[model samples]
Target: MNQEALTFRAATAADIDAIVALAESAYRGDSGRRGWTTESDLLGGRRTGPDEIEDFLCKPRSMVLLGELGDPPALVACAHIAAHDEVGYLGLFTVDPTLQGAGIGKRVLEEAERIVRDDWRLSTIEMTVINVREELIQYYLRRGFRRTGKFLPFPYGDARFGLPKRDDLSFEVLEKTL
Candidate 1:
């Protein structure tokens, strides 16, 4: 694949399935094992599905961006942006596990931020990450996000979210000004 030719654009309603598949491949079980971002040890069960992703696609002032490459442009990654007070909420940021470290994620995020700031006219982008994910947190930190120490309990009953392997699982808020 000509990696340099990869591009980005807003994902449509029809893209929900591809988006879910990409998220799971990047974070779920044995398939995710092919990449460095696997959360299999920390959780189990489905990572995400059409219903959830479709909801994001249906909202106004909201959109899911899909990174593309190749002829048909496989949905290699996705991110959700929603309107918040004076900022934008960025979540569900995902990239194909096997494709990480190739700078595709960085481009997708930068494009998403551009959509949030320039199109939506927001000043900041906020997201939450598993608090114990030191490596993941560091990745965001390197991208200019700061820890706010704010947190919320992991939804234990939601198999869709992931099954916890340990106690003390929660998410911490992180933000970066655009």
Candidate 2:
């Protein structure tokens, strides 16, 4: 992909559907299997629904950032940034499955950190990765985030968060100082 042509901007309500679709493509079904970022083996069901994306976009302290490419502009990448008191939280990150290994996700994450540091004036950007996702965790660690030894229970009963294929799944918090 042409990194020079890519533009990052705040996602609007109109982009919610595409955002959800992009996320599902990266982590949900057989479509997700095409990407290295897929969590299909660990979880089932939709990665994100329209209603959830809508709610996220509606949060006053939160904004969904999108990376678009091409002349007509396609939603190829996205990251969610939200103010959490003194720190900034990043989540709902996604990249088009076909575009995954091409460094789009790295750009999205860098932009997320930029937003947190410049816009939110926060010193830290934090995120949580599924505990068993060691490869994913190493990806973050390479980008300056460190394991904080903090863990949160994965929402097991909530289908909105995706249904677990295994019994032991939790999130390990990772933090990067901006």
Candidate 3:
């Protein structure tokens, strides 16, 4: 896969299925374990479902981004960005397992920040990472995000959010000033 040929764009309702598959393969059950980004060991169930994705697509000020490649254009990666009052929220980020570490995610993150700063005209971008995902948090830290230490309870009993493998799971906020 030649990343140089990859293209980036905002996702549409038509992309929901591909985006769902990409996200699941990157974060969910055994299938996700094929990649370094798998959260399967920490959680069970689907990372996201069709309904939730459709909702994001319909939400105001929200955009789902996809990194695509090939003539038919397969979705190799995806992320969600939403405008807040004075900040941008980034979430649902994932790269195709095989494509991990190929600089694709870095480019996606950079483009995400660019969209926040330029498209949304926001000064700060915020995200929440699983508190125990130190490696993931560090990845963002390298990209200039700082840990806020503020934690939000993971949505328990919400199948839409996934089933936690442990009771202590929570999300820690991370923010970057654009």
Candidate 2 residue spans exceeding 4 A from truth: none
lDDT of 3 by residue, 1-178 (tens): 8898889999999989988999998998777778888999888888998898998899988989899988888899999999978899999999999889999999898999999999889999999999999999999999999998799999999988888889989999999999
> In lDDT terms, which candidate is top?
3
Q: List the residue pairs that clash in candidate 3.
A: none
For every model shown, what is its TM-score relative to the native structure? Answer: 0.95, 0.97, 0.97
Clashes of each: 0, 0, 0
lDDT of 2 by residue, 1-178 (tens): 5866889999889998899889999998989888888999999988888898888789887999999999888889998899889999999888888888888888889889988999889999899999999998999999999999999999999998998999999999999999
- 2 or 3, greater by lDDT: 3
Q: What is the lDDT for 82 in model 2?
A: 95
Q: Model 1, 112-177: lDDT tens per residue?
A: 889988998998889989888899899999998999889989999887788888888999999999
Candidate 1 structure, TM-score to reference = 0.95
Whole-structure CA lDDT of model 3: 0.91
Models sorted by lDDT, best on top: 3, 2, 1
* Model 1 segments more than 4 A misplaced: none
Write down the RMSD of candidate 1 (Cα, Å): 1.1
Q: Report the Cα RMSD per candidate.
A: 1.1, 0.9, 0.9
How far is 48's C-alpha from truth in model 2 (Å)?
Answer: 0.9
* TM match of model 2 to true structure: 0.97
